[model samples]
Target chain A: MKVGFVTPRYGPEIMGGAESAARMLAEHLQARDGVEVEVFTTCALDHLTWKDELPPGVGELNGVRVRRFPSRAGRSAAFYGLDGRLRLAPREASLQEAERWVQLNGPVVPALVDALTRSDLDVVCFYPYLYYPTVRAIGRVPMPAVLHPAAHDEPALYLPVFGRTFASADALCYHTEAERRLVQQVYPETAATPQLVLGLGVATPPPARRPGGEVLGLGDRPYLVSVGRVDEHKGSVMLARFFAAYKERHPGPLALALVGPVAAEVPAHSDVVVTGVLDEQDKRDVVADALVAVSPSALESFSLVVLEAWTLGVPVMVNGTCGPTREHCEHAGGGLWFTSYEEFEVGLERLLADPGLRRTLGQAGRAYVDRHYRWPVLIDRYLAFLEGVLARGKGRRGSSERADQLARGRRAQALA
Target chain B: MVEERLVAEPEGDHAQELVRRVMAEVHQEAARRRVEGGLQASELAELDELFARHAPVGAKGQRLADVLRHVDARSFVDPVVPVASKKAGGSALKRSIRSATQWYVGFVAHQVSQFAAAVSRALHVVDGELQAIHRELELVAPGPAPVLDLAGTHRVDGWWVAPVLAALDGVPGRVLHGGCGDGWLVEALGQRGCDAYGVDPRVDERTSRVDVRAEDVAEHLRGLAPASLGGVVLSGVLDGMAPAQRHQALEAALAALEEGGLLAIQAATPAAWDRPEAPGEVDLAPGRPLRTVGWEALCRRLEVAAEVREGPAGMDLLVLARARGQGAR
Candidate 1:
């Protein structure tokens, strides 16, 4: 069966969880027996323009066909307020500017439309609902489509319209319960029906000793760790405050490592080491060395960092407010929660003081994650769901007569 | 109080009026469709009998002209009219007028209002068929909660753990299980040397250790001291409450916990409860179905240093610490 995977971002330019998930799914499906997978994504990077030529229309990538359409690179520039040439104005003005720019130079929308019209695929799966162009294009397509809404915030924005549109789709896939609930709340009409529920996969890191090789003050001392984009939403500020409080109570040389892409808006703090944008290897190394992984985000649909921490057999400290993070932590049995600054400080202190508790939570977390969020298990479920959707579609097309006849025969036999 | 009554009555009346108007419109459309189908004299006579049995009764002083006027003005503007026109056009137009006349006579005989009397009669039959279909579908599709309950029981087994050491305001103390559903973790906590007790709402009052009533979570908390209860275990409770009930539970849990008391909150991850239901039955379930809050939002709302932890049993564990100051904001 031919399947088309539509995403706003992909491959070497992979920036977010959804893009990575799409790439992995496409690869796995293509490699599987009796499945032909094709990926259609936007090309936004300039220096890597050669990737655009690698697969012009459709070419093979690890057995799957990949199609790259060059999107307007600076579309996020206005949202980020990076370009000085573009005036910083009202939201409406910025939107107008962004729309004008996309109309003039972007191939994101047209390319999606072209792909939809050109491809003779059985099914199309759209990733991340907020990417307006892809969503709009998917809506226009007459064939059966599946939507994998990767985050809570995106659905919260387009749910009023998307909820109705979703009813027409073959299925809607959600990674986290929080995201699903948000969608259900907005579209109450679709709450009683059972839709697809597929788990998300975490990347497997290479085998390595715990970072600093389990040394005490000499190498690996107890330090609370958090890795993600450094923003207020990520809870970097909260982490900083907690770490400071932790230090005052314990009075150790333990360093709180904050690793990931840094935002200019979220200020850096003393004693909190910010490693901005580490490569994959370095990230793994950091996770291995950290005493405990912390996700302080106040608005995460699902924390990939929590999974990374689990893979490394490290305990996680997660913000309790986010639905997915709490779910992941509790399910894994490998984390602690701190609802307030005082609670965070106390939880951190307990973890720091007790090595046994940290080890226990860490091991439990890894075991929990391996059982549920493992890639192989998740991929199998995803494949089955996709196949089921195709089968359901087949049955929907005038095949009720045979079933009706079978039912009549059963009824007649019962009467006899 | 008088003002409130006066305002509420008018609003209620307006809503009733709207429902009546819509119902009248439906009847008129059905009658027009029937007539358009070119019913013979015998068929018209049968339809008159059908209208007498069906439509909303007692539309006072209704006449054939009034019904015609209502039908011409309102029914023509309806979206269903075009579809009906296409389905049964030429013959239906003639049949519909005849059937409508019969309906008017029936309405006049029944002593209903002229404008809606004919519509009410025709709609009565259509509404019954629609209601029967609705009832049949409901029987086929039993509510999702019972199924969820079964699935939840099987999936949530053997995934319990006693929190290593319960802390209250940076001080260690014995943890008590105030309300442990299923005893999965209560048993685990008992083994771990924490003073854990199983409190089941379902258990016989004589046998149960603690009678944990849904309404008395606060009263239950009154048994513990300000800084004595190290941790409160609320598993699968908050998500199962109405909004007001959830608020009460949270408030009670916060109030009961000591300053800096650890609240080990494990809820069914939103992902587990994320499946979309069919349209129109979203709120039919008694309690909220697990996907109550995002982890971040819950942490933020609870106003504690929060971490989203994964339990060994694949349940989302929120190990929240009580704020040292007052309860959660």
Candidate 2:
């Protein structure tokens, strides 16, 4: 059976959590038997600018088909003006205003939406729900639609318009149970929607015992690594600040390595190193020898880096407010979490001091990853979930048809 | 208050114990620091208050459950209509007309208000029922601490496993044993040439058997494709359930079984449960033993061929039902 994925941006170079998850799912699912995976996305590479970097057209990537449609406009100045007003009181906005809010959060790719409507795919999966492509194109498609909301407890999730977006799906796939709870709590009607908390799969990185400190220029001073785009939303600034404070409290050789593309203004500190963008091999190598892999993002649906670190037998310290990461720590026995600077300082001190605790937690985390997040295990569940969705969709259609028939018969009898 | 050990070396693959230990130590340190004023008490209180306010965003005591509560509390719909207009003597004239038609208008308005109030009440019922269903579904959904944690450590065997296996000997598809903790009975069923799996609300993480799911048995049964299972063995499930839960389990089990399939339930007699030797867990379970006569009546109500067999000296009872091959609607 064939399934299509719809996302605003798509590519290998894109670094957003949801986009990376979509690409990984597409690639892995393509390898599965009796399943064909296709991607319906825009030609954008950068999320912030929404520039049409990649050429638009159907192309093949690793044997899977990709259809990239050029966007109509980039992120506009007017969007920020409107966004500022809406974020203050999103639930109170009028329906028209909500629609405008979605449209203004742009990459407004009409051609991509049109392609999705005209396509004959049996099922369509829309990733990371808060986008023009997903909000506009989800329920409008002819085939059964599955929405992967990847929602957080942010103000945007409380917007009046998302209730309908969530309700329109034939099913939903969530990255974590925390995500599922958050979405359903806001839109309670979705409790009835057929869903699977199918968290994204994590492929085990290649076993390479390369020295990580040398690669990141740390040179054996035990460093804490934060992998991913250095963005304010992902808590890069907060983490950097906390690290500097910790350094002042306990002066030592412990370095902080922010190893990803820099997008946020992380203040320059002597101990904190921002290795602007590394290759995948270098990133893994850096993570492999880290004292602790810190995922500072408070809004992660599923922090993939934590799983990657676990796959390398490294413990993690997460932002306590983020449900998915805290859940990862609790479930895997993999790490600890901190909600404040004080908690962060104390937690970091404990981790830096205890080698035995670190190894035990790290090994537990590895076991947890192996038990659940392997590509084959997650993809098999996903494929089965897709089949279940198809069956449920048929059932819904049959029931609606019967209801239609009954209504028509009643109307005809009244006329007679 | 900081604990000595944060994380213990896991015995083989059981690291959850270590996680618990570590979390304890962390919380302990936080508590000690707060008491000793390393971080000011005022600051800690403010932080705790902030976390407490925002932590349960979509959790219980939140919006979905309370959506209709506003209506419930203020269900009285206003029925007043304006009587004044800005014209010479218009106010007096309108008042006079209103007074003349007051009885009829008031009666009609009251009826309409009551109708609105009734609709709100019905909506409240529907909303409440939906929330209840959501909670029940959540009991089995794949989340952290997925199990319901109601099942106890006291296990029963030796009396019913053989009979259940014999009853379901040649069953031709997947067989499910509900409340199969640690999966001893499921293994016995497997050894008896049946493709059996188990589901228990209390799951042992280190069990090594992937087929044993951590979920509510009734909810698990409901999730299956209709008429899919060849046989069903319900052991140690019904004795502690409320009446509605018991009925739901029975219905789900019967619905899941294919036509001509076997349905077996092994339960203890009330005499055994009420005896002083019994564990008396579940805060005195409400649906204990369901009496042999009640089981027979329940079988009859379900409308399937069945037999009720009392164990030696009336310690337990087994009810076996053969499905008439009905659809799973």
Candidate 3:
């Protein structure tokens, strides 16, 4: 069966959560028997600008066919202002204002949308539920569309636009049960859609015992490491403030290591170390040697880094506010979660003071990753879901015609 | 099964109303089709048998059931029996009188049968209306809790744990099984990799779990800070509490719960509450168990969303959470 993927950004260099998930799913599906996989995405690597980087049109990436479309415009300050207003009061926004919001949200590729709407693929999967390419294209497409919403409890998801988008899809795939519940809470009708909680699969990292502190230029000191973009949204600011307070209160020998893209201001502290983007090997080593890997993001669908930490047999600390992270911790029993400074201090103290506890948690995490998130297991579920879509598609022969009628009606209404 | 909050305005309410309207339209269409199909199989069979007994030549000479299939059962007629003798031995007036009496009896019987058919149709329509009303009421106010007797069996199977854990992800703390009757739920949670403990006003020595303690729920909740506890399960505990006490417990549970922490309330159906003979914990409560409507109203008043699900055995589970922006409505 031929399957296609629609995403905002596509490429090996793109490190965004949805982008990475799309890539892994595509690759895994491509490797399967009797499954033909392809990807349709924008010719841009950066999410902020949506600028044209790769040449537009057809190409190949990692043995899968790729079709890239150039965006008409990049994002701007005007877009942010409009988005902020729209998010605050979406119900009040006029049709014209809603259209403008989508336009300015960038990666506004007419060609990609046209392809998605016109494609005859057996199944087209749209990743995450943000961005113009997904939000706009999903409604217009007449195929058996599957949405992997990667939903979190956030303001943007509650916007009026997503309800229609969710309704238009034939099925939904979720990374976690919490994400599924969030989707159901926002759009109750989506509960009727065929949904499966098939989390994105990650490969087990090769065992490398290289000294992490020496490779990442950090001195031999017990520390808590967070591997992701150092942004306020990812709870970097909160972690920084808490670490500073903890350091001042106890004067401990431990440090806070922030690794990944430096997108936010890092709190100035003598013990805090900011490593901006490490190579794959260095990242593995750092996670393996860290006292405890921390995921502070509250808006995560699934923290891939947490799984990576578990794969490397390391204990983790996650923000309890993030459903997916906390769920992973709860189900795996491989980590602890902290909601406040007090909780954070206690969890940190326990992991730091007791080596046995850390080992037990880390081992449990490794077992969970191996048992549930193996690539083969995920691929099998993916195939079954697609087949189910095909079986359900039999009764949906007139849906395309119905979709066309609805589109025409909407266009006529918009013009008037 | 999950209880989801219906969003306000921006067409959220309109969407639900529209769905209900469409469903009513679909139902009307189905009923219309059924009516157009004439008599159903059972009615047709009865009419065919009636014809077979009366029309001997037609019934015996041909396939009577097959012939009757094309005929409307309601319009089928029984053949008039030849009763009066035509011999001119006695008085001609006597034969005439006998024929008139026979005709009168047949006419009276036909009228009564027709009247019965009309009443049946009217009764069917009334029954349909009653069912529709019941369905609407069920949607607005959750139907009575199922009659589940959890008094004797303290089986703490973690069936409700998945949804509760999903709701409790926002807070970081041990799960508090508020009315930990038999310590089974708390033990199940601990086995499922959660830091959980039970609290109750009374404790049983035969309980298998060791984390439970004898403590009042209100007292335990007062000591916790806002958004401190991850989840609090009120399994049949709220039913026994006074209305004001229950209200206060709800306030504390909401306060102690993080933005998305779970407040799981499981209870028996109204049948248990109404039945004096039924031996159950729900019967011990002074007031009625909370229905879907009251449950939703309470959540709305507290500025939270409650999702409710009813089980087969009259057990209802309510999962509650605080909405975004904290009281945006």
Candidate 4:
């Protein structure tokens, strides 16, 4: 099967979960002998010249074909970056400028229509429905489109336009039960239907080489670590308060390390060691050395960092506010939950004081991840799910005979 | 060693001991019968009186025990007995057996019932205690509610502002409505038209769809994106959270919003009409009314948020969103 994947961003510049997932799906799908995969995404890199010119149509990355379409760079900029005009100077810009930006860049519909019409593909999978290109493109094309609405919140776009695209899609894929419920709640009409719950896979890290590392801030001690974008929603402030309370009760040499992109506004704290965006190896090191890794965010679809921490045999402490995080803890059996500051402090104190508990939880978490979240297992599941969707689509089209012939031809081609 | 010290301890002392033991056994049996006989006699008396009043005159006078045995036998013969004389006869028969058993068994059955009741009550208590422990574990556990992605979207049924506002009045702190799509409810409540602003992750200026990721509500709020809203309205966000994520979302909302602001929330009441095996999709269970015990338990643990009101329509129209030490408005 020749499959086409639609995403907001692609390749070396890809950031965020949906983009990473899209890339992974494309690569894995392409690796299958009887399948061909292509990725379609936005081409504008710099926000300033987004309006200047449309970029080239096609490029190749990691043995997969990637097609880049011209989208309003300024709009993309405003949406992606914090310093975009729409974000920083919303009050200063005139209504006309805003309207102009909306008009010029809002034509993702045309771009998507053009792309779908031009390409001859059997199945098209779109990622992160909130993006204009994916939503607009999927809306126009009537083919067997598989939508991976990465988060429930993104459905705000599809809810108004397609009126629950997941329900109408040939097949819908979700990461967690919590996310699936959110979508169902919004679109109650789609209840009791089979939807694929394909969870994200975690790569098992190589064994930890170093015995331990110094706690960066508290001078020669281990520390509890949190990795994510250092934003308020990620629970950095809540964590800060928790750490402070934890320090007062248990004055151990252990420190608290906050690693990730620091938001513009962070709570003023002395003990926190904020390392802004470390390399992959450094991140793995931090995870390995940390006494515990914490996720304070209340709104995660599924946290990759939590799984990564688990893969590294590091115990996690997740905020009880988010469903996916809690599910991770439960399934992984490697974390603790806290609803209040006092409770958080108590949990942290216990974990910090007892190394044995940490080791047990961490080992359990690693084993759980290895069992359930490996990529090879996930890839096979994905293939089976896609095949089922394709078969169902073919049934709907009343083209079983044609589908069989195509399958035979593809098999023959693979053999050749 | 002392010859003749006991001076003729009774000659037949062993025989007397055997006789006493036999007498004691008889006394115990008599006592047991007395208790059992008393109840059985009263039951028979009642049955006799009832028969005299209700049974046809000159009919064979049947003992209550016999009537009860007939009823038990009839029940197996016809499981779904008609509510006619026949059914009544069967019922009366069962009642007669119960009465006769009470009379014949005496206090044994009563004691057994009492013991069973006590055990049942203890088991219930233990179950409740275990549930409480689990709730505590859930509360103290870190992370947010699990996010359940719904398959579709539905328009909210109606506007519920007064009760929600009343609940918010009790919470003395700033509030944020995570996933405030289109700012409809916020604008309706005069939050957005006034000082309240929304921070959606999507960041679209023209439309209300802010692409705020589920995990990023706190991040946007903390950036002072909405600045300072007196109250946050998380209308349907809670239902979307996993048990853990729900806690995290609640904490994040409380943390980012003003200390004394209100958190006016409206969550779904799981549709009562849903069928069993409702798949892995969204169901009406999450929005059900908080049972008395469940509500109280939640209130006790969530010191920052209190359950101001909850009902069948709106599972919980809570108002107490202010944390302790955050003074009242």
Candidate with best TM-score = 2
lDDT values for all models: 0.52, 0.72, 0.67, 0.54
TM-score of chain B of each: 0.41, 0.56, 0.47, 0.39
Per-residue lDDT of candidate 3, residues A1-416 (tens digit)? 98999998988898889889999999989998898888999889888899999999899999899999999887866989988788666656775776777678777888888988788788889987877887787767767888889777765676666666766677778888668656765564453355567787868797786888877677687777899999877788778777876676679678888999999897699988898899888889888899999997777888899999989889888876677887787667778776445456657776788788688778778877886688988888778767766655622212444334333433443474
Please give the DockQ score of every candidate, comma-separated: 0.01, 0.10, 0.01, 0.01
Report the C-alpha lDDT of model 3 over B27-100, residue by residue, as the tens digit: 35534534464435554344233322222111212332233332333433332444445566545566566566
**Candidate 3 vs 4: which has more lDDT:** 3
Off by over 4 Å in 1: A45-60, A72-108, A154-161, A192-194, A213-218, A248-250, A265-270, A394-416, B1-329
| Residue lDDT tens for model 4, B114-225 | 6655655565566678768878997765433222212122123343555555555544322345545544444443432222334333222212221112234534433331
Residue A190, model 1, lDDT? 29
Which 10 consecutive positions of candidate 3 chain A have the poorest summed lDDT?
A394-403
Compared with the true structure, model 4 gives a TM-score of 0.49
Model 3 bad stretches (over 4 Å): A91-95, A394-416, B1-329
Ordered list by lDDT, greatest first? 2, 3, 4, 1
- Cα RMSD to native, each candidate? 28.7, 14.2, 33.0, 34.4
Candidate whose lDDT is highest: 2
* lDDT of candidate 4 over A15-63, digit per residue (tens): 4667787887788778888888888777654323344243657888888
Error (Å) of candidate 4 at residue A179 is: 1.3
Model 4 / residue B150 / CA error / Å: 33
Clashes, model 4: 89
lDDT of 2 by residue, B239-264 (tens): 66666677767877876676778888
